[model samples]
Target: MFKTIKNDLPASIVVFFVALPLCLGIALASGAPLFSGLIAGIVGGIVVGAMSGSNIGVSGPAAGLAAIVLVAINSLGYQNFLVAVVLGGIIQLVFGALRLGIIGYFFPSSVIKGMLTGIGIIIILKQIPYFFGMDKNPQGDFAFLQVDGKNTITELLNAINALISGNISVGATVIALIAMAILILWSNVLSKKGKIFQLVQGPLVAVVVGIIFYVVTQGGSMNLESSHLVSVPVPDSFDSFKSQFNFPNFGALGNMEVWITGFTIALVASLETLLCVEATDKLDPHKNVTPTNRELFAQGTGNIVSGMIGGLPITQVIVRSSANIQSGGVSKMSAIIHGFFLLISVIVIPKLLNMIPLSVLAAVLFIVGFKLAKPSTFKSMFSLGWKQWVPFMVTILGIVFVDLLWGIFLGLVVGILIIMIKSYQNSHFLHKEGEDVDDGRIKMTLAEEVTFFNKGAILKELDNIPADSFLELDVTKTRYLDNDIIEILEDFGLKARERNVTVKLISERGIEENPKSYIEFFKREIKRKYPA
Candidate 1:
């Protein structure tokens, strides 16, 4: 870790910048104290970062759970909600210990891709308002139905009108555009010069420039203040810093609502963390696999610490994880260092941090969003065939219009439906007898594994076999013959004599004479002779 400090330190700084505002924004969205988010960010970094099996994944407060946090806090009160969060953390620990982290693997690759694309689109959509200086909703809020009574589309519509009517901050607009230009230049051109230039990243430069712009343009026509800037709750003294830490109210432990909230947070946070781990692994240039179970354990530990300290729930957030990857993070030390940066900066130069414009961070995230949901991604998925593409598109649309979990659910359903259709069509095939064979003889070959799905086709083929015909039935390669198919064969056997059809059963058991009921043959375990 120390050996890679040269690379990890810079990457950590970039992730810190990316994480700072999100922590506060998600906390605000969750209806919790602003400082609580920072606490989670710090814990996710220092605590979870140390324990996680992932080299590149960064854990922190997640936007995905903001809505749930908001409702829980509103109903249970802050202290009581902390109890639920603590309980949730405990539940996550249980999940990790029991090796439930494998649940993440059940998501199809297509669905995962869809999820990544969906999150990217959401990040872009959610950050658009911030980029435009529309302060109605907090930064990082990505839900479909926003807290401000407007959905994402409506908010976009409102933002457009606001931009047209010049109801925007000139300072924010100018700073954002300039920051984005710097980022584009840094990523596209400047960083290629050498590692030194890469060390001083575009976001760091953009933020410094934004701060200068703020200091120079104060009270001017292009000045930005309050809502247009980053807000890190500044601690006035050592005691004040200590006071920021919150604790759970154990009195709420008996409340069923608290338990329900705890379980909800545990399930959602674990899922989000697992998904982000997969996404981060995919984005890792090093191509390392994250140990999913260990990640859960780490995440669960981070949440427990965070909740104990009056922090919002934490997850392996894609936005920050992506930022770390894009910024060239080399190891978990980057995440740990970034956590320290958060801890130190808020206590030391918070006033300076507060000077940086929110628009600059918005610009940074906009670039991240663009990379994750590139137009090329859509085209790539579309070329993969309708079976893969349909679910991918549906997941994107579902996430855009509904929510994250729901979108994946819809996509999974579509994926399974397509699979069933293919199964029904691909169950079996029929072949004609060779010219060398006697006339009126048909050779029927069973598929690799004949399930109930093939029963219909088999019945149709059986009906077409003319009377007094000789049929050669081969089950030599067949495996996993379903009971329904076996029953169909039994019925066919009963009527074969009436049609004067001579049946031949070829198997490892050797060719048998006119076979008895399939139920008897299967009960005798003849079908089990074939390999699966």
Candidate 2:
């Protein structure tokens, strides 16, 4: 762990910047108290991060859960919703205890790729409003438009109006732009020159510059708008910490709606966490495989902590996890440290965090967003074969045009269809062609449980049989010859009449007759062969 610290500490700084805005954004979208996002972030990093066996995967309040949280809060009332959060954690714990983590392994590679690309697009889309200083609606919501009568485009238009009305903060804009530039330069340019600067981390440098720029702009004469700054509810002391904890109404726990909400949260959160873990492992240079069951256990524990402390539920997040890996994180310590940083910062330096301009965070997220939605990523997915590419493309479209889980589900469906199609296409049996040593005499066999897709292969192979001596079909073991294959055999049997070709039927499942019309004969013969 100590050896890991040297690597993870540098990575934590990068993760910290990435996580800060996300925590706030997801919380804002949830319609829960803004502090709840931070709490989830803190607990995710410290509690879950510390407990997690993952070296690079980071956990926090996921945007995927934002919609569920919003609906639950409104329908169940805030207090009752809290009970669901606790129960959801318990359910996740049960999942982990039952060793259900292997479920993550079942997701096809295509579906996972599509999921990653889709999520990247979502992050980019979600951050667009923030980049332009549009805050009329919540942050984490993925719907193009919110129920509050504003959407990504509308909010952009409103932000434009705000700008025209002199609402845009020049200081925030300048600092954000500069921070972005510094980050790009430091990461892409300076870091390549030496190990020291590379180890310093670009996000860390951008954050420092953003802070300095903020301080410098504070002394300037520019009339800056107030909405540009980060907002954190500052707590004065230890006594204030006690007040932050929230309690769930246990009496409401038995409500059917509450249980429904709990199930929703648990299902979505688990899926997102598992997907993120898979994707992050792919991104890791060391290729460390995170123990999924352990991760679920950690997430469950984190959520329980979050609910007890008035925080939102948490999940493994790709953005933070990627940042951790990219920034040189080697173990869970970095994640744990970042969580502690979140917890302590909110308590000890809430005012300082609040001073972090939203635009600056937006600049940071914009970079992260670009990393995710890069054209190279799309190209790479395309090269991985159609089985992978189709699902990958669908997932991207579904996420860009629809929602997260829906996109993944749609992609999975497509992937499964592709698999079934291939399975059907390849369903056939073969026998080596031989007459003793090198004779061209061919023998054909029918596959068990063959489908209609096997029609062409069976027909072509049977049609080419010579009008002479040796042709053998070994269907003795075939339990279920599809109607299609049977039809071919029946038609070939009729053709064999004038052709003088010898035919042999060896079967425990198929028809014994050499029938009349290929299609009609097979229909009758199949029934006669197996009268069940």
Candidate 3:
């Protein structure tokens, strides 16, 4: 882990910057104390990062859970909500133990790519307003319909209006533009020239410059307001800092509502974490595959620690994970160090951190977003043909127009439909041409796996067989034969006699001429394999 400290340290700083506003913003969106979000971020980074198998994946308070947390908090009260969070973590541990992490692999590759692209688009679109200092909504709100009663488009329009009316913050705009410029220059040119440039990342430089700009222009017309800056909870003293931590109400453990809320958090947080794990693995330059069960266990542990000390739910978030990967993080040390940075900074230089402009961070995210959803990605997916392209496009659009989970769900549905269509079309191979047709004989070979989904296609082809013909039903290579298909074959076999169609059933078990019962043949084969 220490082998890549040089890379991990610098990447950790970038992830810290990327995670800071999100921690606060998600807490605000969830209607919890802003400090709670920081607590989750700290625990997610430290505890989860230490335990997680993912080298580049980062965990923190998720925007996807903001709505659920919001409702859960209101219904259960803040203390009770903490209890739910703790319970949720326990549930996640159970999930890990059950080896349910395999669920992540079940998602199609196209849907996963779509998710990454969709999130990329979302990050870009959502940050535009903040980049211009039009902070009408929380920075962490990723939902299409926001808590502010406006959607993504409406917010963009409002930002445009603000820009046109000169209502936007000129300082923020200037800072963001400069920061973006610095990032591009550093990535494209400066970083390549020297080891020093690589050591000192562009995001770190941009943030420092943003802070300097804020300090230099203090009290001037170009000055950014408190809303345009990073807002870390500054503790006046040790006692106040300790007071910020809220303990979960153990008394709420027996409440049915608390259990339900806990289960909900566990389910949602696990799904989001698994999805992010898949996305993060794809994003990792090292091509490392994170152990999903370990990730679940780590997340569950993080949530428990976070909740016990007053924090929102935690999950492996794509935004922070992608930022870590993009920033050159090479190991889990980066994630762990970033958590420490969150811990130490809030304890030490929080006021100084508060001086950094949000727009500069927005600029940082802009680059991250573009990397994830480059135009080349869309073209590549399109070139893969419609089977891959349709689901990918649907996921991207769904994420942009709806929300994260819904978009992936839509993409998965489309992907499954495509799979079914392919399965229907490729259920069987008919050898009807040349000698087979010329001799009034036809050969129908079953696919490797014939399920109920292939019933229609097989039935159609069976019905098309002409009368007084020789029909050879071949299952020699079929690994799995669905009961429904077997029944269809049986019915066809019985009716073929009326059409004077001589039927021959072929399998590895040998051929049956005019078989009386298909079910009995399979039953006999099964008994042969496992005798009583």
Candidate 4:
């Protein structure tokens, strides 16, 4: 997994860029100490990444949970909230131990696709302001509107208004355009010619250009303000760095409200983490399947560590994960490297990081969104038929209009409805090749696996079989038959007897004539076939 340093190294830098602003902004939005967010980012990247099964996923302070954190802080106090975070981590560990991670598998593929597309659109919408040098919303915000009461489209229009009103910073705009140009050139043109371009990525060059532009425009009319850039809390000395870390209050351990808050954090964090795992796996070019249970365990540990030392709860976040993938990350090492970057950069170059313009990072995320929500993706999904398309579109709309979890829930509901309708209509399990034989023979082929869902269909098919029909019930290809379905088939044997129908069970045991029940028939058939 660590073999692709050429790829992972540059990807780490891109994710670092994406993670920096988000960490501080989420911390700000959560009403927590600013340094706490960096702590979460570091723990999420190194601790969680090292333990996680995800190859491309990067964890950190999530924007989705910011509102919850803020409310908890306001109600319970910051120190008390930290105790809840620690308890939340413990709850997550319990969830992992109980193997509750299997819940992630229940979501339909269509819903998951919709989620990715919806998030992509949201990312594009959120970054539009920053792209035009507007700073009303934070960088990684996914909501249609913001805490400031402006919607995505309105904010987008505001960005355009700013552009029209001559509010654009020349330095930021120039660097942003150049950054995107260099990115396109590096990916399409330069990387193909030599190995040098592959080692050093476009985002790094973009950051360098942004820093230079900031220095050059410092005293000019076009100078960008501090608000238009990253803002990690600057520590003056070792004492300052030590002062940043805050421990959870033990006195809050006995509070009932703290337990409730911890449970809320655990539930929300787990859901977000699972969704991100699914989305990140889909985004991966290699299609590596992450161990969902292990991910929960890793995240729980991360939250415990982060909460213990003045940080917000950690979850696998899509924005950072997508940035890592778009930047050519091949393994978890990129995520781990990014954590170190967060740690070292804060200690060494907090001011330098603040110099890099929001527009430049916005350009990087814009590319990520483009890759996720390509028009071709929509076309391909639409081509898969309405059974798939309806749920996918609904999920996208719900996510765009509503929040993430609500949108996914709506899509899942639709997807399940489609499945039920299809299952009801597809009750004909017996595939009859020809009409009938001279002996009044009719063959019914069983599906590969018969489940309880097919019980109604099987009953209907059995109830309508013609009288005196010599039915050859084939289970040769069947693997596992559900108990409910077996009962249905067993009851059908009595019906077959009353109708004077000859039931020949054709299975791995060769054949049986007029068996008593499906269960007895299966037992005899197995005994004869295995013959141990």
Candidate 5:
């Protein structure tokens, strides 16, 4: 891990900057204490990072869980909610032990790509309001419908109206534009000139410049308001900092509602984490595959630790993980070190951090968003044909129009439907008119793996066979057949007798003329494989 310290250190700083505002914002969105978000971030980075198999994935309090956390906190009380979080973590550990991580692999690549692209679009859209200094909505809220009672489009329109009516802060716009310019220049030009430029990242430089701008323009018409800056909780002293931590209420353990909430958190957090892990692995330059089960265990541990103290539920977050990757993170050290930075900054330099403008961070996120949803990505997916493109587009639209989980769910549904359609189409190979044998027999070859999905297609073909016709049932290449298809074949055999149809069954075992019973044949085959 230390071998990549040079890369990890700079990346950690970048991730720290990216994570700080998000941590506070997510906590605020969840109606939890702002410090709790930082606590989750710290634990996610240090504790989970240490245990996680991922070299680049980062975990923390996610915006996706903000609504659930808010409701949970309101219904259960803060202390009881913490109990749920701890229990949720325990459930995640059980998930890991059961090797449920295989669930991540089931998500189609197109859906995963769509997820990344959709999130990128969201990050860009969400930041637009902040870019224009409309700070009514929390930065961490990524859902289409926001806590502020406006959707992304309406919020954006409102920001534009504010700009037109001269109600928006000119200071924020100016800072954001400057930050974007600096980032563009740094990435395209300056970073190429020297190692020094590479070592000192553009986002950090932009943030520093934003702070300087904030200080210089104070009391002027162009000065940004406190609302436009990062808002980390400022504890007065050690005692105050110590007081920020809230312990979970053990008394709530017996509540059935608490258990339900715990399971909900565990399910949602695990899904989000697994999805982010897949997306992060795709984003990794090294293309490293994170062990999903280990990731669940690590996340569960982090959440447990975080809940025992004062913190929100945790999951592997794409924004931070992508930020880490974009900033050249090569090891888990970057994630761990970023946790340390979150810890140290909240204690030491929170006041300084508060001076940095959200507009500048918005500018930073703009670049990240663009990288994820590049126009080239769209063209590439389209070129892959409708099979991949349909789900990909659906996911993007769903994510942009709905929410993260909903978008993924829609895409997954579409992906599965596409698979079913393809399976139906490819279920068998039928001999063309001229290809039939001289004996006027019709040949139908079953696919390698015929599941229940192919039952309808197979049945339709069988039903169309002419009376007194010769039919060839070929299972030469079939490795597995569903019982549904077996039943359909058996029924067809009975129908063949009525129609006076001659049927030939071809298999690896031997050719048969009208099998007596499909189940009996399979039973005999099983016995052939394992003789007494």
Candidate 6:
């Protein structure tokens, strides 16, 4: 891992930058303290990332769980919510131990693709407010309008009006534009020139330029008080840092609300983690498979640790994981080092960090979001056929219009319905035989695995057979014959006797004499001697 430090370090930095705002934003959305996000990030990076089996995936506070977290916290209170988070972690550990991690595998590929594209579109939509300096609403909510002040569409309109009103700062605009330019140039132009440039990612360069631009625009040193800046929480000293730790109220664990919240968190966070792990693996350059069980264990541990320290629960997050992989992270060490950076930076130079500007972070997120919603995503989904495309399109629309879980459920239902319809259609009867049985000779053939649905067709053919004809019924290749079909055959046998037709049972299961009833032949010997 150390041998690739040159590459990994830069990648880690990119992931770190990308992760910073998300942690805060998700925490805010979850109704948790701002510092809670930082704590989750620290634990996810250092603890969960270290324990995780995935090389490229990054674990952190997930936007997917924000709604659940918000509801859980609101009902249970912060202290009780903390206990639930810890309990949720314990439940995840149990899930992993029971080998239930394979649940992630059952999702259809089309649904998964839809999920990725939906999330990408969501990230872009959610971050638009931050990009243009609108911070009234939290970032995770999918509603068109926000509980805070505006809906996504309405807020977007507001942002546009604000832009026209010149509410955006010139300094912020300059830094953001410079960062975006640097990223675009580095990725599209400089990256193709040489191995050296390729090794340095666009996001990393954008970050450096952002900082430099902040300095240049200010004409001096970084200062939160005087310039556009990041807002890292201030912990005055070692004692102050220690004071920040928060413990869950064990006494509240017995409350019904607490348990309900725990179950909710466990379900949502685990699903989100599983989905992200799968998605991130798809994006991994090495095509490495992440151990889903281990990922659950690691996330469980991280959430437990984080909750104990006043942090939000964590999960395998695609945004950070993709950034980590795209930045060239090769191992868990890059993730771990990035966590350490977050931990130390808060204590060492928070004021400097605070000067970094939200616009800079917005620019980075903007790029990440665009990559997810690219036109290629649509083309790929369209190629998968109606069986897949229906569910995929439904899921995307559900997420865009409703919520994530709701969208997934709607898609799943449609997928299941489609499968059932296909099954019903495929179960139809088929016939094969000579044009007709001439000269008082009758012959009929049954298709493989005759079901009750085929009984109707069999009866129709049997009714047509002439009286006083020599009949032959062939079921040689048939593996399974339904009870209803057997009943139909038995009834037909009685009619054949009156018609003077001699019925021949030509089947893999040995034929029986026409002297007995069809029902009797079907159940002959009761469980004793029968045709092989």
lDDT of each: 0.85, 0.76, 0.90, 0.85, 0.90, 0.75
Candidate 1 TM-score to native: 0.92
What TM-score does model 4 achieve against the real structure? 0.84
Residues 320-413, candidate 2: write the lDDT tens digits. 8877876778888989888888878887887787666677777777777677678998888788777788888998888766677788889888
Number of clashes in every candidate structure? 0, 0, 0, 0, 0, 7
Worst 10 residues of 1 by lDDT: 427-436
Candidate 6, residue 515: the lDDT equals: 57
Candidate whose TM-score is highest: 3
Model 1, range 196-249, lDDT digits (tens) per residue? 788898889989998999999998999886888898988889999889888999
Q: For model 6, where is the 10-residue window of minimal lDDT? A: 219-228
**Against the true structure, candidate 6 has what lDDT?**
0.75
Candidate 5 — which residues are off by over 4 angstroms? 427-439, 513-532
Q: Cα RMSD (Å) between model 4 and the true structure? A: 4.1
- lDDT for position 181 in model 6: 84
Arrange candidates, best TM-score first: 3, 5, 1, 4, 6, 2
lDDT of 4 by residue, 1-532 (tens): 7689889998999899889988887887787888889999999999999999999999999877887898999999988999999999999999999998888888999998898888889888888778777764456556665667777778878888888998776766777888889778877899898888888988788778888888888889778778877777788899988999999998988999999999999999998899889888988999999999999999999999999998999999988999898888999999999999999999998878878889888888788788878999899999999999999999999888877777898999999889877765563455764445566777888777677767777778778888988888898887667778767777777778899998888887588788666557766664554355
Native-referenced Cα lDDT, model 4:
0.85
* TM-score on alpha carbons, each prediction: 0.92, 0.82, 0.96, 0.84, 0.95, 0.83
Query: Who is ahead in TM-score, 1 or 3?
Result: 3
lDDT of 4 at 187: 79
After superposition, which runs of candidate 6 have C-alpha atoms over 4 Å from their true positions? 136-149, 164-167, 218-229, 427-517, 520-532
